[model samples]
Target: MESLIKKLSKSHKDCPECPSPKVVHSFFESILGLLFPDFATELLKEEDQISEKIEELRHKLSRILIRNKHLHDGDGAEIAHLFFLKLENVYDLLIQDVQAMYDGDPAAKSLTEIIRCYPGFYAVAAYRIAHLLHSLGVNLIPRMITEYAHSKTGVDIHPAAKIGERFCIDHGTGVVIGETTEIGNCVKIYQGVTLGALSIEKADADKKRHPTIEDYVVIYAGATILGGDTIIGHHSIIGGNVWLTKSVPAKSKIYYQAKMYNPASDETDTYIIKSEG
Candidate 1:
């Protein structure tokens, strides 16, 4: 007991205290509620009340950043101010994402439903918020925020991944978007999709390790695209269970052909590619 206590004491002293999970979650929920009323408990009756709420959230963020100043380079208060200034653009992008999800999914009856119930919206919302903090040079908190969403939604999107506007993730369970993955506009990915890397070498950590999906690409459920150099061109349809590690040109359709499902069969399947006329 003495040895264990002595060992933990030094490491505990060395490690700086970070913002508590409750505090971080509160900040996220407060900001989200302010943006979308579907998530808010009560609506602000006046413009002044709304303005006060914004300032309060800003102060909350300032405190969070100030608490973990060791993770990033800059003043926490200044970063908080700048983050709010550019937050309107993020809100606009989120609106576009919600619209895209509604238009893409036939089952979706209204925008309110998607905003209130969809796991994709929750995951994407976390990602966008984290991405903005990441851009402001804040590090650990962004990751913490995304991981919280991942825990709830089963969608693992890294804080650093570059995702374009109007992105839609339908039935988003078991979806993994890696750190270096780059996705373009109007791209839709279904459940069990893994946009991953071929290698896990620590030496290649600084290099690009994930594939790029171009505009208007639809990646269906259970598709796995890997390797840094692999690029799926615009207007491509990647079928369910299709795995690709090489670049495909624009307007291509890729799918795997299997005669029948056999749990007992240990057979290898090949994917067929078709280019649009």
Candidate 2:
């Protein structure tokens, strides 16, 4: 017990001070609350109150960066200032995302409902915010924010992934977007979809390991598109339960067909891809 205690003490002493999980979650929630009326704890009555809240958020981010100062470059205050300067652009991108979700899904009743209740919106919002921080070279906290969304929404998106404008995720559970994944605009991905790497090799860590999804592509549920070289062309439809690792041309339709099995030839599998080209 004494040896274990001493080991734990040494580990604690060696670790650098970073923002706590609660602080990271609070920071994310605060940003959401500030941006949309649906998530706000209480509406700011005046313009001055809104400005003060924004400043408070900036201060919180600065303090978070300051705590893990060694993990990044430049002054924390300067980084925080730069982040705020670019925040409007982020808000604009999220607005586009919200529009995409509302336009794509028939079940969505209104814009406010998407903002308030959709897990896909929550997950993508976390990604956009974390992606901004990642761009500014703030390391650990960005990951924390994305992970918080992942834990709650079951929509796992890496902060470093490049997602284009008007992207949508429907029935978002079990969606995985990898670190190096690149997604284009007007793309809709359904539940149980994986944009992942073919290999988990450490040597490929620096390389683009995930697939590239072109614009206007709709990848339905249970579709697995893997490999860095794999690219799904624009305006294509990738159907459910389809597994793809090779590149397909534009306007392609990839799906499986359940054929009647041969009773005499010892073939048991009934499902086959009628055309995966």
Candidate 3:
């Protein structure tokens, strides 16, 4: 046991370049606080204090870049400034997402409820922020932020995914949006949905692997759509538990026809349980 401990301690000492997870998490929290000041406290209610909050955000981001030595190749202050320049745009997108959730789900009571409690909203907000960092060519930090969101929300959205405006993720748990997945505006997806690739070959890493979901598409829970060429066309409805590998045309409704069994007659029956077009 002593020898094992010594070896483990040696391994830890050797890897001094590893980024601290605690610092990453703290940075993410700071970003969230800046974005939604009402999230943690009522301290941001006054309109006059907005500039102070922005400066605080800028300082925190600068500190984060300094702490993570491997990700400090460029001007940290400049990057922070650039990020804040698009802060209003990010907030606008988040508002649209919240509105999408409220409009799509009949169970949603108010925008306030969705903003305060919805895990999907939380995940989407994190994704938008992380995606901005990714687009700006900032390394490591984007993945860290998104992974933190995934850990909290069970929604695994790769920072590289291209998702459009008003995208709604209902229930969100077990939802996986791959790196190359492209989702269009007003698309709504439920829990246990995988917009994933059919293959995970190392050679296919640079290629488009995940499916494309066009505008106004609704993918129900447990639907798995795979392959790069697979596209769910505009205004389509994908039913629950359906596995799709090929492309579907616009205005299409795809569903699985389940078989029903009865014990009394020793006979099997097949029926279309759900349908919508």
Candidate 4:
């Protein structure tokens, strides 16, 4: 047992200190608290004390980055300051998302309700934050932040996915957005939707593996769109449970037409399905 303990200690000493998932999550929570002060009773209101909140957030971020060895003291401070400077733009995008959610869902009572109660909004907020970090070339932390949101919401969005403004994910549980997935603006996706790769090979690592979703496309629940070159064109409606690997043209409507079996009728036939376009 003593020998085993010594081996473990040696291994521990050899490994570099990775960023603590707990600490990263705490930082994520702190950022969210600043973004939505009303979510937490003790959080300082952004409107009331913007400068103080920014400073506190910047300090916390700098500490995390420095501790993780991702950046030097000066670099960490500069990055944190720059990130906060972009916070207003992020806030605006989040508001657009909230509005999109409210407009897309009939059950949504108001923008405030969407902001406060929607899991989709929560996931989007996390993704937006993570994506910003990813764009800034911050490693590991972005994935950690998105993974935290995935744990909470069951919406797995890779930080590297290029998502546009006004993106709406309704009933977002089981929604998986791949690293190379490129989604356009005004895209509405339902639960169990996967914008994924056809191949999971190691050689395909740097390639565009996931599909591209064009603007105004409505992807329904349980739809799996695969392959990097596969593009769901603008104004397309992909129906629930549809499995697609090929690209569709603009204004296309693709749906799975299951054959119906009427026991009394004694007629078993499948009809041709056509795109609305």
Which candidate gets the maximum TM-score versus the true structure? 2
Off by over 4 Å in 2: 259-264, 268-271, 275-277
TM-score against truth, every candidate: 0.93, 0.95, 0.87, 0.90
lDDT of 2: 0.92
Residue 185, candidate 1: C-alpha displacement in angstroms: 0.5
Best to worst by TM-score, what's the order? Answer: 2, 1, 4, 3
lDDT values, one for every candidate: 0.91, 0.92, 0.87, 0.87
Q: Clashes per prediction?
A: 0, 0, 0, 0
Query: Tens digits of per-residue lDDT for model 4 on 215-276?
Result: 99999999999999999899999999888889999999998787887879987866444577
Give the CA lDDT, 0 to 100, for residue 145 in model 4: 97
| Predicted candidate 3 versus true structure: per-residue lDDT over 1-277, tens digit per residue | 9999999999998766556778767766766776776475546677667788778778878766655556746677777888889878888998899999999889999998898889999999999999888876788888888899999999999999999999899999999999999999999999999999999999999999999999999999999999999999999999998888899888889998987687898868664534454
Which tens-of-lDDT digit does each residue in 59-164 have in candidate 2? 9888878877886887898899998899899999999999999999899999998998899999999999999999999888889999999999999999999999
Root-mean-square deviation (CA) per prediction: 2.3, 1.6, 3.2, 3.4
Please tell me which predicted candidate would have the highest lDDT against the true structure.
Answer: 2
RMSD of 3: 3.2
Worst 10 contiguous positions by lDDT, candidate 4 = 67-76
